[model samples]
Target: MEKLLEILNDIQPDADYETCTTLIDDEVLDSFAILSIVGELEEAFDIEITPVDIVPENFNSAQALWDMVQRLQEA
Candidate 1:
């Protein structure tokens, strides 16, 4: 979770990822930022984020991202 936060902070330092649940809805992360996040996440956690996983729900907040990472790691 800390690493996920670090990745998100590196990509967008302005947003409060810890409590920001409207990251996608509020446009806190643009398309490029999302892509960068996906790349960082995949490389950091050794998880493959498929197109199917690229949904607003999964990228909404730090907790959601952390949950997705854990799920993928178990797979």
Candidate 2:
């Protein structure tokens, strides 16, 4: 969770990771931002983010991102 928050903060410093859930819904993260985040996540966590994993539920918040990372790492 902390690592996820770190990654998100690096991309959008103004984002409140704790309070935010739907980053896209809140307008905190757009499509481009999600791409940047995917890049960072791949590098930082050593996991490949597939197109199938690019759903809004997976990238909605810090918790969701963390969950996705865990699932990918397990895969």
Candidate 3:
């Protein structure tokens, strides 16, 4: 979670990641930011975020992203 926060902060320092629940819907993260986050997440978590996994529900918030990462790890 700390590492996720770090990456998110690097991408968008102004947004409150800890409590944000509408990252995508609120337009908090644009295409470039999302792509950057995808790269960072893939490298940091040692996971591959394929096109199928790039959904708004999966990137809604920090907890959602963490949940997706954990699910992918388990798989």
Model 2: how far is 1 from its true place, Å? Answer: 2.1
Query: How many clashes (backbone N, Cα, C below 3 Å) per candidate?
Result: 0, 0, 0
Model 2 residue 41 CA deviation in Å: 0.4
Which of the predicted structures, 1 or 2, would earn the higher lDDT when compared with the native? 1
Q: Which stretches of candidate 1 lie over 4 Å from their true place?
A: none
The per-residue C-alpha lDDT of model 1 at residue 72 equals 97
Better of 1 and 3 by TM-score: 1
For residue 73, model 2's alpha carbon misses the true position, in angstroms, by 0.3
lDDT for each candidate structure? 0.95, 0.89, 0.93
Cα lDDT of model 2 by residue, 26-69, tens digit:
77898888999999999999999999999889988888899999
Comparing 1 and 3 on lDDT, the stronger one: 1
lDDT of 3 by residue, 38-68 (tens): 9999999999999999999999899999998
Q: Tens digits of per-residue lDDT for model 1 on 1-75?
A: 888899999999999986789999999999999999999999999999999999999998899999999999999
Which one wins by lDDT: 2 or 3? 3
Q: Give the Å shift of residue 61 in candidate 1.
A: 0.6
Clashing pairs in 2: none
